[model samples]
Target: MTTGRHAGSRAPGSCAQSAPLVLALLLAGCAVGPDYHTPPLSGTEAPQGWHATLPHHGSRMALAHWWEQFHDPVLTQLVEQADATSPTIAQAVGRVREARASVSTNRAALLPQLKGSGSATRQGGFGGSQFAGGAGGLSAGALNPTLGLGTITTLGAQADASWEIDLFGGKRRSLEGADARLTASEADWHDARVSLAAEVANTYLQQRECEALVDIGAATLSSRQETLQLTERKFRAGFVAPADFAQAQATVGDAVNALEGQRAQCAQGIDKLVALTGLDHDALNGLLSKASAQIPAPPDPGVPDVPAQVLSQRPDVSSAERAVAGASADALASYRSKVRQAVQEVEDALVRLDASERRVDAATMADAQYAKVLEASNARYRLGAGSLLQLEDVRRTALQASQSLAAVKLERAQAWVALYKAVGGGWRDDAPNPHPDHKTTAPTAQGRTHTGSAS
Candidate 1:
């Protein structure tokens, strides 16, 4: 907070005599440790545009409160509940408070320290004995000897003040470090909240995806059961080979098995959500019973093409970057390496998202083609132009393709979730951006699209 004018300005007249000494001491009082500076990213890694692909265009994305973009009231409620209840978030908050207290402690060192003390003493002496020795012993004895053995009491109190002037600025450096650490703790809190929200979303999405798959399995099972019944009628009439009926029965069994697996997945998903939200099974089941199997698609947080811009939104990255500024050369390298790893994570998420999208496209195509082949096989079999084996084969292929497409869709949804997480979710321009060097364009004020852009 000191200005150059304040540090250099001299007192007038007689005071000028001590000005040089005062100035010398003040000049000597410089922060001893390395001053905090924002670490620079390699230009190539965070060029003008992010080297990664931009999903689509719109007004700039809002990173803060990003969970609200999902447009699912349940999701919003869940995230809020998690934030309020999560012990992890509570721990992070405690750390922030601790860091704030440390900053206050370090700052207090810059001022004079005052202490108060008091003491009391009591002494007794046989004054008569000494008087008798000095004067006539008989006369001193006649005078009350006990009277001379009086007790004396005394009390004293004092106050002290002392200060160690920050000659080498070590205290100042400590304060600076404390302030930086406080900032890092605050960023860590935000990072924790961001991570919590993402975790909740991912878990919730998984639950919903599990539900969708279960429904798919059940529907496929119902269709397979009907086919098996029809094949049984032909077998009973001796109009079809026993293998045809057995094949249909086996298909039904497989469907039953698949449905059981899907149900197990659903249960596991629910259990995970229960663990995360700390909700009882009955309450969670009731909450989800009202919800459809459709996945919750949050709005796309149109991640900037600039790597630095995206990195700025990540509180973890910001915390690490600040840490680097306060670290020694070796520690600085370690912190910087963490930042690099964070960037690499985002890159990996983007790659996975890309691959997931491709899988969805392929699965969609395969599902549609298989459906057509199954339909044609059914028609040909009904017309007595195709074997029941061909029909069953096509039916299984179509069902498998349908299930595969569902799985891919779920994977793509997860990838979208990961991408959102990797790109820093809702941490954005208008909020207290974690990155010290960030100054990106403001996010749009318009409401987000409910149908996730990834979908």
Candidate 2:
């Protein structure tokens, strides 16, 4: 060893130890640039093929084609057409183009721009006096007089350009920000597709459900009308009291009114579906005639996966995650804004989870209460003490409870989708492009309950 300070200089490991420093300096010496350590990401593990709890997203999401999940041909056609021609999707495409243009504009500054410069001029004196200095004339002192328009225009083709050099990394950081924004815009486009698909699917579901309700109402009304006729005949034969006949008529009238209300709701749902597909009512009716347009209870939707992120292909979830990314990129562009908005978006997302939990709880409670009512009514009927009115009241209560439970479940599932999305879950499944190094699944809020109406 040469000395204490130089002792380690020649050591075998010393070179390796200094390699990191050398590399750091090499990176630093080129320019003081913005080193983008990815913003605090929500996910950690690469999303494992649509798990319930995956964190990082993949290159593409299945939910991007959400309508296909319903397996409706008409819906698929409408979605494809809407995707190609809808103003909303067109707007999103325009945004992508604009962001791409911005990136190009910013990147263009990274390289020297060459320009061919040329100028032409016709020099003339005031009042047509003798011209002295023109592009084709001699200098003022070399001319006979200096009173003419002295246009000493140089017509040389000169290429002039400049770049910031990115020495301080400012330009590079700006470029990074721009690049991120460009990608974010692309994500935004994908998000728009997802939103449209979801809107169509959800609305289709609504219309179908409305159709089912109308069917139920029609059946109930027809049944009550028959009962009323039976009661009137029995009263005419003096087999039942007049009060019973009147009651039957009243029940029939109620059923008729209910059916009319349901019909109106079904028509409104038809209008909503039409709006979603941008089709006229006649066109919608034509489409409806070709299909059942009936919505039954949806299947468990295959549960999507345990953590639910396994189905990271859900469009709503993907949209949420894209929003998170957009907010993240936006934050990078404006640091304080990112932090503030990140919290806000996260809060909003968490709230959805909270709302879902609450709805589930409420539905559970409602189911229990209605269960008690149904049990009581059954017991009274068994004892021959409960009137038909009492039995129907309890039956209606139980039915309403079931419907409420279903609605709550649907909303809860939707909230789960919203939470996963807000936290950037779906994107990590099939990212549709390269993603930052992080796993796919992430949660939005604390696992706890909060309240809201499911609808």
The per-model lDDT (C-alpha) reads 0.68, 0.52
Summarize candidate 2's per-residue lDDT along 1-455 as a digit string, tens digits: 35965866668587888998788667657664334343443332222223232222222234334445446677667666555556786786677567656656766777876765655554434434444444443343222255543343323345566654555555555555555555555555655655565566556666665665666566556655765666677679886678877877887788788879877987887887766667888987887766653443221222232223332333333333334333455544454343334344434544554565567788889878987887787567545476546655765676577566656655654543444343333222332322222122221111111111110
Model 1 scores a TM of: 0.78
Residue 141's lDDT within candidate 1 is 28
Residue range 1-455, candidate 1, lDDT tens digits: 35866655644544789888888688775647544566666754454554455566423666556667777777777777777778897787677677667767988999999998876655556754332232211221233355656555455677899987788877777766666666667667777877888899888887887887788788878877877777788789897899888888898899899899989988998888777788889988888887768776445546566677667766676666556554467756666676676677777776666677778789889989988898788778766688877777788788789878767776776777677677666443344322233221122122111110111
Among these predicted structures, which one has the highest TM-score? 1
Q: lDDT at 43 for candidate 2? A: 34
Report how far residue 33 has shifted in candidate 1, in Å. Answer: 4.1
TM-score of decoy 2: 0.59
How big is the positional error of residue 267 in model 1, measured in Å on the Cα after superposition? 0.6
**Which structure among the candidates has the greatest lDDT?**
1
Worst lDDT run of 10 residues, candidate 1, spans: 446-455
